[model samples]
Target chain A: MKVVVTGGTGMIGRKLIDSLLAMPELIDRDGNMAEVTAITAFDVVAPNPPLPDDPRLTIVTGEISDAEAVEALIDDDTDTVFHLAAVVSAQAEEDFDLGMRVNLDGTRITLERCRALGHVPRVVYASSVAAFGGNMPDVINDTVTPNPQTTYGVTKVIGEYLIDDYSRKGFIDGRALRLPTIVVRPGRPNKAASTWASSILREPLAGHSAICPVKEESKMWMLSPRRVVESFRHAQVLDAVAWGPHRVVNLPGVTGSVTESLQALSRAGGNSARARVTFEHDPFIQEIVDGWANTFETARGLEMGFKSDTGLDEIVNVFLEDDLPGQHVYYD
Target chain B: MKVVVTGGTGMIGRKLIDSLLAMPELIDRDGNMAEVTAITAFDVVAPNPPLPDDPRLTIVTGEISDAEAVEALIDDDTDTVFHLAAVVSAQAEEDFDLGMRVNLDGTRITLERCRALGHVPRVVYASSVAAFGGNMPDVINDTVTPNPQTTYGVTKVIGEYLIDDYSRKGFIDGRALRLPTIVVRPGRPNKAASTWASSILREPLAGHSAICPVKEESKMWMLSPRRVVESFRHAQVLDAVAWGPHRVVNLPGVTGSVTESLQALSRAGGNSARARVTFEHDPFIQEIVDGWANTFETARGLEMGFKSDTGLDEIVNVFLEDDLPGQHVYYD
Candidate 1:
């Protein structure tokens, strides 16, 4: 089976690629465990430190919104596609046109290219917790309607609907995972508003000071990179019947405030590491964080066997174990 | 104020045009009642019976997905846009590409054109109750997440999100109405699964026999053409504060079974009209209708002062009073 991964150079994408390489037998369309013969990593930019030098793995760079590029990337031999390319929250908010072009139009291009292939390929799309916002329920359940306040959220929610529709039409056997804020993201903080969620944990653990923008009590729904990759693999193997007609699932996640996260930080890195975190409230970030649905009851995801990190400590630990060693070599 | 109405030659669009012509005023961005100086009615095809010959109304034929056409149709002088153009349900199901091109791509093009103008026009988008389907609660409320079962429904729901996002970004001041299946339609039945909802009453009232394709107990959330036009006008005039961030509303509607609709038909046209209706189940159509959301509790729409027909009887009366006379002259 030939597999394609968009955004293959990003954090989760890179980890997912590594995981796929290590254990590459994915369930094919005929419900059989097939050997992954080839893997294509398509993205806008090349891998920074470079991906595995395995002969089975090939990396290609191009614009996701470019239909011609996508067409060349996904061909008849492609058995599965893990589409994770996107502009993060804060960046999408800053540049609406760019966000729409990449997130919305790019997704459509990918889906259309897949549909043109005729043979149904399992497509695992990355959605987000940003799918819910503004006047949300105290605890967002599976039934809560997505009323996203940001362009990024809107695009993600839109992608889920498209995935469902395309799957229903039998164009593609698709699954969309509404991922939570990934905690302890490795290397440097990027443009996402929730970047602080990672910075507060990742920076302190790495013996560097990090700014805590929001109040310590401000909470977020979060997951670990390892669990998210596991969820993606699990999402792919689940039969079409397991997904039923609605193709999107909000992945189960642990909800914690900065105070809780800091406690976990203290547990792993001690008071010295925890003390590296300093409070300097940015109300702009606070208002955006306050708008997110922090508490969730992902009954469907749990039932489907998609897992979350146990808590903030486990999330931090995952970073320590999986990403911490390589962080300095890549960024600094 | 100059206004543009896409799909302006269709049933609700024509009536909406008449309502606007009669009223001649709409709430401008300044929150003042401004006279409608010009009304451009844009559609894929020319009006069959031709629109009102009034000096203010100009009917233009063009494809909605044509960006250049939409740009020309909606210039800087345009103060409001009623984006009602779309491929109806059954046809969209059969021709997936056509539906995506016209409904999804068309909407995005229109939004982009509006955004380019920088004037922020008040856009009243026509969504549908089709936005809700699949495993639904016994009663759909304001909070039920849209899990559209059909391609048509998917496009409509996607349009609502686009409207909300555009409004949020200050590119357009937008409002979307999740309309119910319109009843007692005057023309020949189109490809919509719910066309029978109108046919069961319309054909009988016009002294022609009609087929009831589903069981008598199969119900639908319905509204009248008159009321829908009023809803559009009301939706446009309400201040942006009333809409807040979420610009979509499930417009108020009454749920009525086929038996109930037939009784209303009988009341208006006697047993003769009721007798004209005969049951002949088309499982294809029935199954599609069964997937629709038949009941709703539109609290937000009501609070915002959007109204529903009192009952099925009122719906029957609306056809008789507003559309019945023109039915023969146009179709026959």
Candidate 2:
């Protein structure tokens, strides 16, 4: 079956596509074999992507918010829809109008199209821990009430509601996965609030010490790119009845404080790696890090059989393995 | 003390304005005398006001959503804002764009303007119990998370977030009151889904039987128009700190079934009123009513001293006494 991914040029989308490409056996159904039909991806800045040349893969380069583009994207063979399109936190905070039109309105058009279609498709929406903010309890569970503090969170919350409503109406088998910071992020970083997670690690590996915003005690939740991809794939085939009416669930991830992250870096890195890691606290980021939490009791997800990252050790190692392939790690 | 009411043309708005004009006690705080200086009310339609000629009241008629009109409506003497502008469920469910512009964007503009003027007014906003929908258990407490089910709820949810954000930033002392469905509604009938609560009794009063939406077994929450006024007034002067970080609180109300409502009507009617109450099952309305809910522990509001109409006997009497003044009965 053909899989369509919106916001395909972005960080998670790119990596997720790679993971999907790597998998030969995508549909694991009982007593039946399903073969790939096509793989289509799109973004605003049309990139000549390095996609599989096989007839099984088709790539489209356009803006997802465009109604015509989205209408053209979904076809008869299309069964899986992974919508990752959104203006990230920092950008959203800066430009309110752009955020609303793109994030809020964009999701609306996507939902409407899927709902208008006669048949239901399994839709995997990329929600964020940003969906929950304010003073969080030590471990936020699926049951904990999310009092979102920012525009970004509000938009996602609305998107979740739309997805949930559509699912209830039998429009689509929608699943919204609230992802944490994907540690050891690949590619160039944008102005997203969580970009520091990558900058702190990426800069150090690239022979430069990065500024650490927020306090050492400030904590955050994280998952590896590999795990993120796995979560997306898992959402596609999860038993809808088993999930019950809960279309949205908090994702499982490793929660760690800046101090713990730095320590892990030291353990994994030699003197050169350690030297590249430094601290420079910024008040704005501190306020956000304190307000936006990372530790959540993801009991619902775990109970549903979704696993979490081992720890910061595995998280850092994934980055080291992929980016600094030539470097040896003491922890490993 | 010019008190500007954004949605002053609405049912609760009219009652609230009447109460404010009658009592004049709202401005009892030392510097502000408990007497009306003027009343500036707005709506999409020409504010067909009751024409309060108490000499102190002045009505400025215009659309609250129009920024210029809102500015023109406000004067230097205005110290309070009872922002109640919103497209109700029936309208919101039909049009998404209208709901967003009215509920969410209008709120933002109002708060932003207040923020700009450095005027942190005592702004009492009208929220709804609908904000507390979806997977909600019986006897929902104020602390119990709001999982809004409809588009109207989404806007209210975002409105609460914006109110809290403004309050936290010291822009406005925003108080969000989650109002229960007001029963025995006065004036012309409305298309609000909850109107059946008032219609069933009102129609029968006019010697006509009404169709009962949903099964009689379905339970939901409700309040009277007077209680709605009381809740709004209470929110105006409540301790901001007591409201704490959460400006939103579910107003307490009666928990009962449609049969309970009809039974109360019959009991209160003494054969005369009994003839008017009849039930015919409509599947569509039944479907909607099945989704309607009424019940809240509301311990938070309880501690803060908010009250709901208790006992169908007492509630039915309140409706009769308030809406149908001459009609009264002592139910055994």
Q: Pick the TM-score winner.
A: 1
Residue range with the least summed lDDT across 10 consecutive positions in model 1 chain B: B323-332
Global lDDT of each candidate: 0.92, 0.74
DockQ of each: 0.94, 0.36
Each prediction's total of clashing residue pairs, residues at least 3 apart in sequence or on different chains, is 0, 7
TM-score of chain A of each: 0.97, 0.91
Candidate 1, RMSD to the unseen true structure = 1.6
- Give a tens-digit lDDT track for model 2, residues A1-332: 77888888776787777777777445422312355556787777654446555565566877667888888887656777889988887777677667766787788778767776656877889888887776667678777776777667767877787787668667777889998888878665566666778767766765667778777777788888878888887887787775777688888999888777777777777667667767777787677777776777888888877777799888888887765553223123
Worst 10 residues of 1 chain A by lDDT: A323-332
Clashing pairs in 1: none
Candidate 2 displacement at residue B279 in angstroms: 5.7
Chain A TM-score of candidate 2 vs. true chain A: 0.91
Off by over 4 Å in 1: A330-332, B330-332
